[model samples]
Target chain A: MGPDSSQDAQTISQVGEFGLINRVTSGRAQSPGTLLGPGDDAAVLAAPDGRVVATTDVLVEQVHFRFDWSTPHQVGRKAVAVNLSDIAAMGAVPTGLLVGLGCSPDLPTTVVDELAAGMWEEAQRVGISVVGGDMVSATSLTISVTALGDLQGREPVTRSGARPGDVVAVAGRLGWSAAGLAVLGRGFRSPVAVVGAHRVPEPPYEAGPQAAVAGATSMVDTSDGLLADLGHIAAASGVAVDVRTELVEVPQRLTEVASALGADARHWVLTGGEDQALVATFPQGRPLPEGWRPIGAVVEGEGVTVDGDAYAGPSGWEHWR
Target chain B: MGPDSSQDAQTISQVGEFGLINRVTSGRAQSPGTLLGPGDDAAVLAAPDGRVVATTDVLVEQVHFRFDWSTPHQVGRKAVAVNLSDIAAMGAVPTGLLVGLGCSPDLPTTVVDELAAGMWEEAQRVGISVVGGDMVSATSLTISVTALGDLQGREPVTRSGARPGDVVAVAGRLGWSAAGLAVLGRGFRSPVAVVGAHRVPEPPYEAGPQAAVAGATSMVDTSDGLLADLGHIAAASGVAVDVRTELVEVPQRLTEVASALGADARHWVLTGGEDQALVATFPQGRPLPEGWRPIGAVVEGEGVTVDGDAYAGPSGWEHWR
Candidate 1:
């Protein structure tokens, strides 16, 4: 998938920029929105609703991912997964992706192949395609993914749409990624699910659209802890969000791993982030969508609270910190 | 525009991530296409044509820019300018931008403000807004820009449509940016126009749509040298392109700068890249569009030649090299 290996293993500089691009992108399928894919000045995507939802994120080496801790494939998958989660948060169907990769010239060409393969694998799962992107030489490996999605004529479910009395629910596992991170940090290999979760999060892709269709008042993806991201909703919607700790069902795998490590699992559930779970507030009395579990409710006020009290222990992950 | 002066002129680590985001994006006006801007899960933009054109580029510190040579403002502007040039090459009007920034937490908070200001200033010039983006701490500064454009019901001008009987034309200044780079390398800054050209290129943006309307068969931006970029057109279209050196008019300022530096002005004109000038091929017997000057012609065969001969020079920039 990379280059002729009969000769000596080639570095990226030996392969050249265009050569690497040709190798990585060859024979990949295009999605429905891709009118014109790679190998052009720009890519064209169908935005049938006269609107396109877009988001971008940059993951730097050592900061977002470590080569010592992850394979290039996992880095690629995580980059795409987090971006797709953003689209899912908007209640839009992901259609296309543009990736910008910066890496050292001395790096092996096979690493880039693995990265592309991982990105392609995850993108295929969500019914989207990598439309276009750029690659350049840098001191470190950095990934920038720009995700485009189609609204399908639905209003974007913004974080500002929640109101008092709306029911807050979550879809997908929480704290697994955080638990995985802890496991990796401690150099423990037990609890495969937890470790795998940190490597490649399985976000509830369908839950986002399902919530929107079920009339979710507001929505968000848990990238910065459940409470912290919900705090954004509260701040934006101008209402108080009360999360019920007892009602929250902690995943058994996380609990087992937490106990093994002599830590509280509830802390992970409450403050751990990057699980990409869909947290949404639905209109009162509306039945929860498939795969959703009720965890909280909106109240009349500002800021987020737990069981009507400000229960906080390390609010969230702040990049500057 | 920045943090309070009373508190040790704090770094990003002291100001925090959210504090920086709020300071940079607060109270900025949004364009019509920006249905939702920053501070959301994702931003939504109007496409209206059922199609959207997208492109992305990543500019790494030291590799793409040097802090010693340019201000944060110039770096930000160049990042936006280069990406917008790709959109223009597609014969589409840019509608929005999504920026992803990675920087060391030790950087001063004011540097980020200047960078955002420069980005906002440039985006406003193109009649769009910075719709969405992500920022995170890294070892060094890196900027990734994703530009979205609307074709407005026009067929995209791709590089693969040139016919044998076509006249090649170019709009906007050539060699000035290259000359400016040479001037900067020599630590001389007398030629404001040339130096400024390198710092902030004023691409013939309007020429893209005008050429499309005038029935340009194929179009490309000269991010690579004219010969190298034209080689792409030739390869894509499977047609030979010939340049008439005498027909290529060199601007007086470029010639003066080249003479002063004891350099071949034609070398800069032929092989210098990053001009972002729109180079296009139109059917023979058709008058060139406004602001476009005739330079060469398309012929039956493959590859690019100058004055009926293959001119020899370093073709263009190679990122991996």
Candidate 2:
């Protein structure tokens, strides 16, 4: 056995990346779905459905999460959630994940375990499993997760599929995470709705396949706020989308954050991001599925419009800046 | 078109990881292999072959490469090299790489660009492509890369297949990179061969497939040295491996360092790691191809020995520590 072989009390940094990696992967029981997992050139996953949907997201410490504001658990959940939302955007059911982690050597070993736990928990929420991952030492903590999804024989509903006269609908909460950001930023506490919204976003993971089955012409994940994401759809599909602000049922929690921050609730609703909601365009004659609220319509022009005009305050969230 | 558009002149510490990342990945082109690529819920890639080989490695600033010691190009090449070596270890041809970079925002954009150029240069060397990557701000520069490869319809040659009668062979340079390390460590300008080895490792990309085609039963990449990697094969295959030390050749460049450091050149040859060479087991009667040199033979025992004993020195390299 390697010298630092104790199951406990040995920090990963002390052993280094390869040593810690060997310890983490040593003696793990293998599962059937894992044709070839970690320790190989690449993981060989059986995508029974021909096409596989893949997405990668990188989360850096401080920039992506503040230790002062978010628990390690929250950071891990957010990392996984953001990547899973990408899979949902593809209208695919996530199947496995390949994580590349670089953490400061001084970070507690329990932090890695906690992050993995958060990833597993959220992955389980979508009935997906975390197949394998790698850990390395760095000056800061980062989680780079690549989610693999199974399309299940369905054509992926891309953002470039919408056409004129399609009804635009959205599923899941919008602007909640951004509103929670206000509370976290202002050091506000005890608002269950606000705090809960920030810690773990409830992405409508199911709405994607539902829309796919419901014959959606185009779909996208509401990552960069509704307007910006819809604008992406409009640009990619070469059709304009007109959104009606009257249809936005702003949750009371967001309204309170708006009051507290002296900021517009519509700013969060229109431009704030990270809800991981699903938005799709359905043909006018087709009916929208349950939980999908009609908030807009695809039109002849190019670009996205709020109530038929370019009404914007703030834009959507960006990963880096 | 975001706030990070600010000329990328900020110091690493100023804007944090998020800002740095936005600056790094701002305008890189996305290849056709990418279905979703960077931003969305997840990315979708076309895996025409049913199986994919995956490997990840992390490089810390001071540990993997010192900002003061290594050029960003060297760091980038090393990052991609280690991952590519993993793919080669599994007898797979690397196709694409996904990078997760964390760096101090204050770091020069030219430095980061140099790193990317280095990655592209080495990637082209192996015929693999950089499909997608993520950048974020961090306390220092940390490079994480995940390589995807295809085995071209051949079964993966795992470490579990070395038999008693197999011959051990090596492909690519040994002790060169470690000699290069000694050059860097001693802060000496001499031993240019060693320094060159340190700056860039030349992994025999085709040697893995060649070994596979030549009927290799087991294989591994010599990142941690011939002994340590051979030990892996021995442990995994339940076979003993003995290296013929007399047959081992040490290049001329390692002599000066060995003398200055009061180290045995043999130790660097047998135990020195990070050359990214390939080692494999072939049938006793068969001859290896041009690039490979038969170093030893597999025996019935359950461990590795040099010249029929436990020849030990520094063992092998371990990251983080």
lDDT of 2 by residue, B42-130 (tens): 45566656665667777777867876667888888988998898888788787677777776656777688789878877887876556
Clashes of 1: 0
Error of 2 at A133 (Å): 2.9
lDDT per residue (tens digit) for residues A237-264 in model 1: 9999999998899878788999989887
lDDT of 1 by residue, B1-321 (tens): 343564447788887888888878999998988999999899999998899999998989888887776788987888898888888888988999999988889999888888999889888888888988998988878899999999989999999999998999999878888998999899987698888888877788889988988899999999888999999999999999999999898888889999999988888889888888989999999988899999999999999999999988888888877
Q: Which candidate number would show the highest lDDT if scored against the true structure?
A: 1
Residue clash pairs of candidate 1: none
Q: Report model 1's TM-score to 2 decimal places.
A: 0.98
- Candidate topping DockQ: 1
- RMSD (Å) per prediction: 1.8, 4.2
Those runs of model 1 whose alpha carbons end farther than 4 Å from true positions after fitting are A1-8, B1-8
Candidate 1, position B272, lDDT: 87
